[model samples]
Target: MFNLFKDESQSVNSFFLFMQSLANRNLVAEALKVSEAKYRSLLENMGLGVIYLSNAGTVISANQVAGQIMGLPLNNMVGRALTETCSRIVKEDGSVLAHEQHPAMLALRTGKPVENVVMGLFNHAQQDHTWVMSSSVPEFLPGEREPHQVFMTLTDITRRKRVEEESSLASVIVNNTGEGIVVTDQDNKIISVNPAFTILTGFSRQEVLGKRAHCFQSPKNAIKIDEALRNSRKNGNSWQGEIWHRRKNSDDFPCWTTINQVKDATGRTTHHVYVVMDITHLKKDQNRLGFLAYHDPLTKLPNRMLLKDRINHALQNARREGSQVAVLFLDLDRFKIINDTYGHAVGDGLLKEVATRIKNLVRKEDTVSRYAGDEFIVFMEDVSDTKSPATLARKLIETFNIPVEVKGHTLQVTTSVGISLFPRDGDDSDSLIKNADAAMYRAKKEGRNNFQYYRPELTTQAFEKMAVETELRQSIDKRELVLYYQPRVCLKTGNIAGIETLVHWQHPVMGLIPPARFIPVAQESGFILALGEWMVEAACRQMRCWLDERVPVNKIVVNVSAFQLLRSDFLATVERILREHELSPHCLELEINESSLMDNAEHIIKALNGLADAGMDLTIADFGKGYFSLINLKRIPAKKLKIDRSFVSEMLCNSNYEAVIRSVIALGNSLNLQVIAQGIESEAQKDKLIEMGCNLGKGDFYFPPALPDAKNLTKLMS
Candidate 1:
């Protein structure tokens, strides 16, 4: 009985210990549940895109962000293996990623951990590659030697990668652009500069970084560019246009720079960006073109255009100071004979020597110019009296008396000089030049190496003018008068635009008399009314022939004088002529001088408007040469505005003239009228006019005014 009692007591003690152990086990299990819930909540709410993969490549769990990034539902991935064929996987370098190279596979196979591997995986829903930074760590159970599964974690890095790629591309472009780029801090301290900036300024980044921008050199502008920044911030503008900057070599150059300031959201300035383009070459080109425009290339003397300008200026000064200005026109007597005898090379040398001698004999204030082929003009400003010019003329005639040795050839060259005094012989440059030219011809007639003063009565006496007028009246017939054509061609393409008709008298003695010599007489005698009709009829016949021959010349530009415009029957005469030749009025363009617009504007406007309504293009010739109100200009019906030859000739060299030309082109554009430039004599001039927006031009650079044969006309138009 005593032994049974001891066994029962031992059983009771052992049961009590088992109950305590079971209670402890329940508490530990509850704690583990709570910890797991907190961990799951934290991962689901986190910003990081998370995905967990098992050692066998099965997607075990994923957060919502991961599902969004992978473009597939996490619920679908929970029980599925992410096999190699399940997605298109690639490495960071965009090459195909093998199964063994995958982070999860690498960790599982090697029994190690792979951290921060960049990988690209195909998204099922988005249908594009999703980049990720992935890490895989092998897990071991208790005391196992190898990992049974891998805890593969993925974090989407697609956006950051895209930004990095774009930044790299931007860096490449900033380094390569021709214009300079400069970045500065708020204090105008240089922060960064492009390769172009180094090339333009000859200062490398190591030499200029953290230094004040423009520390090495100073421009003519204000000492501080902060004022510019303040103004720009106030006006919401960027400071731009031409400014001079100094280079590392201490050379000043002009640059077109734009200063842009960067501001924070509150408008506090934080940085500045300067975009600079060196325009020194452009300035040099302009200077060279200016010199060429005003001086003759061969003799290095002023050309006719410059001489005209100097004469105008001299006359103005002479008028203001009560001084006399003398103009001397010279012709190399028998120069053509010598040129034909010894060839142009020897003639050229002789001419150069003669020019040097003539230039040296003149006063400092006088001007010498190569007026035309084998002709030279000299003008003296602030002349004391008429005798001064006579004495100078005598010296000029005596200077060429010495033989000029040219190109190993002994040559005797002589000049014929004619002098015309300003405000006495003629008032303006044109009249003075014309009268002097006539007197030179008189000197040639009298004897070769002599000087003569201008005589107005000798120009053309009343009887001689009457005889010329009688001859012009009879020469209006078909056989005596002829039409010469010059084309207004496209400046860029050299394609003919329209044919301009010029009247020429095929005189028996004079050979060919330009209208300049006889048009004034025709106008004064009321013979232009008949002369205009004859020109229109001849042009109409020519147009019909061209049309029949299928020549592509579109329109015939006929010159209409003021006399013809003033006559009431002018429009009817044009219509009758066109009807006679069965020509379309649209094929005939009528050009009237701009001065004629002011002479009875109402009647002229009414008449021209009638023609315009009939499909004829009316052009205002010498557009800038005349003075008329915008109202009259608008009221006149015109299809084209012809910029005078004067503006076109000097536009490349003279800023004032260029401004005038630019304004006229702007006006023409605003009014919807075609702007045509005259005297496009050089390729530079032609290119300049085209750049200024004048497309159509006419000059001897293309061809002198002549009657074109059918074959050449077809070729030209073609």
Candidate 2:
């Protein structure tokens, strides 16, 4: 019974011990399963890839991340040889890695750990190569001297690698590009510079690094650049503009610069990148173009365009100051003759010299500009009175007194100056210039080498002249101009000897416009030649009519202007007129003024001889009023000389005038020319003229100037 009890106790004890051991073993197993589950979860869920390789470089186990990174199925990767699965592994240099050199195999071979062994793997599923950083540690079973497997963690760094490559390529471009590039930190200190920057700024990277960007900018522009950068950063943008920069040698140069902010993912400005381009040559070209637009090429003076701008500006100032502005229009006298005789080269030189002299005479505030051919304009601003322009004019005229040596020719020239004042002559540039030109024309008419101010009277005269000219141009076509006759009576018989033809303008609106009102205008406006031709034709036709009507008439005298007589075709025009009217040339007489005959005596002689040869009578009217020499008078082919109306009218009043008339009559008789006295309004005057040996007379005393119609003319003849 004791033995049975002992055996039972031993059995129970043994069972108890066995039960305890079984419990311990169950707890251990449960803990081990939990550990394995936690490890697998860590390997699968972690961002990095984890793999277990056998000693022979085969894949023993791989987590989900490991399989995905290797581009393989987890089941297929677990049994595959790691060397075969990753056969496309290569070093960063693109050289293929041997199986022994792989991180997993190397860890196993050397019984050590491998860290950060960067390599590339070919992803078969993705059909691309992926970059990874691999680290491995050898694993062994208990009591085993050799490693059984390799535990590896792989991090896919493909994006980081690609970024590094791109960074390298960008570095190359920045280094070689022609435009300079500079990188700066957030503090605006230079952090890096490319080779192009060194070439552009004459400073090396070592010299400029860590320095402020303003160090390379001029002192004048440094503050500007800083303010611009601050504004740009505040706006969260880039700034581009031109700046003047200083080089290492302290020389300044112009550059077009662009500064861009480099921001991180958070949009915080971390650095600034500067792009600079040299623009020194471009600025120079722009300045040159601007200069050429405003300056004359020949004289280097301001041109008309710039002068106009200046005048406008000056006028503005003058208006503000309550002062006057004067515009002086100057023309070189007889400059056309000089240009024709001396050639354009010499003319250009003369113009340059004239420009220089004019510039020297004017104040710095005044502008002297070439207006056009042989014309210059001076703009005077803030003038106190008219005398300012007059004084300047006198100075300019005095300057031209000295001869200018041009092309070895010592040429003396003079300028006719015409001044027009603002608010008086004109209110604008165009008007002022036009009025100045008109005044300049008046100056030329008064005689060149003088100056004249624009007058209201001159404007009125100019308008009247223009009106006459406009009317005269159409007068012939309109036939508004008709002929009037003044009978020339024989003083002894008191009978009409001849008729003097006069032109009359039968204006439609105004009453009869006298010859005095339009004759001078016609002469100056170059309309006299046409008027003279029409008068000759009309006179010839009237004579032919009278002859056909059997009216007694000795001759018809037509007054001719100097311009008409000087025309090369005058004789032909006269002959043609006579033929067209079917009149005898002997029935017509041409009266040329003494001044016309004295102007070009030789040409006048030739013309007179031609008229005489054509059987036309020639007479010199207003004979005593001109400076005619006896030699030139005798050379004239005139058969008759008419005393001036001034001498004729004053003969009974002023003895000096009577003496002059008597002397002229005597001179005419001595020259064997018939003397005719005009303005014989009284019989006493006519008798005096007859006593003075005047063969003919015509005045209101005998017959007033009447219309040359047949009725009035036939009555006067009867």
lDDT per model vs. reference? 0.83, 0.86
Worst 10 contiguous positions by lDDT, candidate 1: 216-225
What would the per-residue lDDT of candidate 2 be over residues 186-214, giving only the tens digit for each residue? 99999999898898889999999999998
Where is model 2 more than 4 Å wrong at Cα? 1-307, 320-323, 330-377, 381-385, 392-417, 437-451, 456-461, 598-602
Give the CA lDDT, 0 to 100, for residue 261 in model 2. Answer: 92
Query: Tens-digit lDDT track for model 1 on 1-718?
Result: 7789889988898899898899998899998899989988988887766666766677778788777777777787776777622477888778998777887888888888999999888888879998888888888889988787777667888998889878988999899999988899988899999999899988888888998766644467543365656666766757876667777887777887778988899987898888889998999998978998998877889998999999998889889888899889999875754664457898888878878999999998889999987889999998888899889889999998888888887777788999899899888999999888878867776866898888977578544777889999999663889998888988888888899989999998778999989987786566887898889989999999888888888899998976666566678888888898998888999999897675445656787888888789999889898896778889978989999999989988899999998898999999998999988788898888888998689998886787867455456766
Q: TM-score for model 2?
A: 0.52
Error of 2 at 589 (Å): 1.3
Model 2 pairs in collision: none
Winner by lDDT: 2
Q: Which window of ten consecutive residues has the lowest lDDT sum in model 2?
A: 334-343
